[model samples]
Target: MKNKIIGVCPNCGANVVEREKGWFCENRECRFVLWKDNAFFKRLGKRLDYHVADKLLRDGRVRLKDCKSAKGKTYNATVLLSCEADGRSKFSLEFEGGC
Candidate 1:
């Protein structure tokens, strides 16, 4: 099956396509990618779905509701997407009230 075009790579402005294991940049030399089974989201008891991925690519951040913590508590926060020097995606969480 052909991979679906999800978004544009923030790194190289190439098409970002969804693959079996992850979303990848069409430009082979670009390292931009978003893994389907992203470890960061897994730790938050969440999965990185297309909706979230789209927002991250388009806006550089996404507001997530009802994220589960390791302690089983739920909270809302914004997920920020940043690219490393090598084009790998990195994520960070921002809570309300500056906490």
Candidate 2:
């Protein structure tokens, strides 16, 4: 089966590999990792957070205003995220790229 590679690393411009532990960027300088847990959730925001930023920084290849990687490629997009109805919580990437 073709593994659905979601996004790209925003740190070192490398592809992020999904592991049982979490996501990992295949870059020496970009050692980005994320897991699903309490502490992980605590370090995030309602709509978006550090985890989201980390994901974007480690697997989000974009070039927009509300985006992080603005030096790679220019694409119109509006990413939507969802998570527990709380303030400090890790959210999931719901929407990505429509324009």
Candidate 3:
């Protein structure tokens, strides 16, 4: 059967589907997910939405507006999608020339 394109996993190009809490990759090996309660986005008074998920899945990076800095400052920046050594996803802010 053909898998429906609900969403795409940013890591493995697998199908992603929305669950009660978030979106998850269908492949167990590719455990990429965008959690609604992600602390990073929560701090910014925002939640991970469909657009963010779609962009991260297709493009490896996404530009965000009004993101809160850990130091209690707010700014706009590009968030780069990366995978950790443990096969988990990691997000880091990218500045002018570096992360």
Best by lDDT: 1
Question: What lDDT tens digits, residue by residue, belong to model 2 across residues 1-99?
Answer: 643344565444566565555555566555544443324233232223344544454433212233323354433343332223321223333335434
Q: Choose 1 or 2, whichever is better by lDDT.
A: 1
- Model 3: per-residue Cα lDDT over 51-89, one tens digit each: 876787778788888787768787787778777665567
lDDT of each prediction vs. the true structure?
Answer: 0.92, 0.41, 0.73
Off by over 4 Å in 1: none
> What CA RMSD would candidate 3 show?
3.3
lDDT by residue for model 1 over 1-99, one digit each (tens)? Answer: 888999999988999999889899999998999999999999888899899899999999999889999889999999999999999899999999893
TM-scores across all candidates?
0.93, 0.37, 0.75
Strongest candidate by TM-score = 1
TM-score of 2: 0.37
- The backbone clash count of each candidate, in order, is 0, 2, 0
Q: Model 2 Cα displacement at 58 (Å)?
A: 9.3
Candidate scoring better on lDDT of 2 and 3: 3
Q: Indicate the residue-level lDDT of 10 in model 3.
A: 60
